[model samples]
Target: MLRFNLLLCFLFLLPGKHLFAQNQTGKRYKIDRYNSIYLPLGEISFADKLVQFKVGNPPPIKKYRDSTQCLHEPNYRNYQTPNFISLGCGGTLTVAFTDNGFMNLPGDDLYIFEVGPSREAAKIEISQNGKEWVYAGKIAGGKSSIELSDAGIDNETVFYFLRITDLKELCRSISAGADIDAIGAINSVIKLTINADVLFDVAKYNLKETAKESLDSLAKIIKKVDKATILIEGHTDSDGDEISNLTLSKNRSISVKERLLKIFNNYEGYDFEVKAFGESTPRFPNDSDENKQLNRRVEITVLPPKDYYENLINK
Candidate 1:
């Protein structure tokens, strides 16, 4: 009888043990403000509950410690119903948010973090209804933590998230007041800014053999963000007559557009707007050879909506 009771006890506990292990499989971890990753030792949920440390204080750990020793912050930065996207690269991570999702905020803040081997860079963009994206500018860098505040977000569902493509290993934790949706506004612009002199034969509109390298880079950026309205703007130095310079710039810009279209032949439902400014927009003064070299350039700016630009600038 004693042996039988022991056997019964073993059977009863077996299922419970298995279930407990399974429950911990999908547990979320935190990457705290101090740039540490921590697992929760206590029960934690996002539903009206705050994450508190077992010892009642923020846990301190050595900088750049192993993942297991790191602790994450419990509270997430609050937003005014905006949408965002984040991307991580080698020792850096970037997060961007737009004001077109929840509350039509004008400016969106991009959060950048440098953790380990990755370096972070962020570009904040805006759109009227999340269907377009316009460049704002590069946000300030060199922070372990940042909050993208002061963007003019109105009461519309703003779309935002992160794009984490460059890093070998990536992980994240987000505490949001509102539910996150995967659906985002389709981007409609492809902008490319390349140093023209570096890409062409000297004093000629024709592309040098080495120019393909730059074009190849442009091709890659375009491939990642497919389906965009392409605007190709060509610029030239202030050396020759304005009319001749404009003509050369226009030809060069057209050449780039044609090559891109051929390379991305399979991408359908996209339009192209090719224009030549011809020495109109000089990136640098034409006083020296270096500056003149800089002046001869191409700019691919995606024209989203007016509100998109407004939001980006305001943010």
Candidate 2:
């Protein structure tokens, strides 16, 4: 499930982590939100679409700038009420986005919708300033996606532009080229979390300098949330004396809250509450060092007020 949270709450896990089965404790899996690039902040430029590629009025580039990646889904065509077609043959299209470029990450996808009756082939390309373009490669009509690494281009290449060109020769009717519905700079949600060991020394609550970067990034996100309550939770493994463990958890949660306040105090419209679970809320048994490390952590959860949604809708 793609949660609307736009940023990762912690560093992402390695591949196959998503398939990991949950233990009997009922701990929900975390969603990855690190690399998400919000769309509606992009535009399609220098595009050509066949007359048949569009059902009625001239195709608007705006149609393909949304989050919808409706390919092969019959009910969704052209992205809007009118379906889409290709440029017949030799037609090309390009989309420019705000992100410096897409990253070379595992399971990344560039979604594109293809029209039917017949599948067609198309060439894809990437660019930095839009003036200089690089070959990305061919995309089959029905696959509905492209791999960023397939271009095998420099991972440093900041991708601001995407191009698709129809390859079919001998012009057919209309809709010969590739028809598109939407494209995304990213494909999944991102999560951000900091390991307790990394953020603090053993049995200590104060954050180390190494933890500053992560909290800085988190602070920016909190500011962006604008209006919301925050929940600062402190957790600990089943180690040391039980009373000390509970006190350590409380002090640690307070430490994080104080640091965040120093950074976010300038802003208004927000408040926070603090709580500590001690060893009672073990994500995993503290039978192993690794599990113990996992148990000792602090979490920040953004809580929008009850009327937050209602207020936005009424606005």
> Lowest summed-lDDT stretch of 10 residues in model 1?
41-50
RMSD of each: 19.2, 17.1
Over 117-152, each residue of candidate 1 has an lDDT whose tens digit, in order, gives 222343444443334544433332333222223443
Task: Provide the overall lDDT of each model, using Cα atoms, as 2-decimal numbers.
Answer: 0.43, 0.54
Question: lDDT per residue, candidate 2, 46-151, as tens digits?
Answer: 1212111222222224443222232222233222444443444566666555312353334433545454445567777777667788887676745555666777
**10 residues in a row with least lDDT, candidate 2:** 23-32
Which regions of candidate 2 deviate over 4 angstroms?
Answer: 1-67, 70-192, 306-315
Candidate 1, residue 80: lDDT: 27
lDDT, model 2, position 219: 74
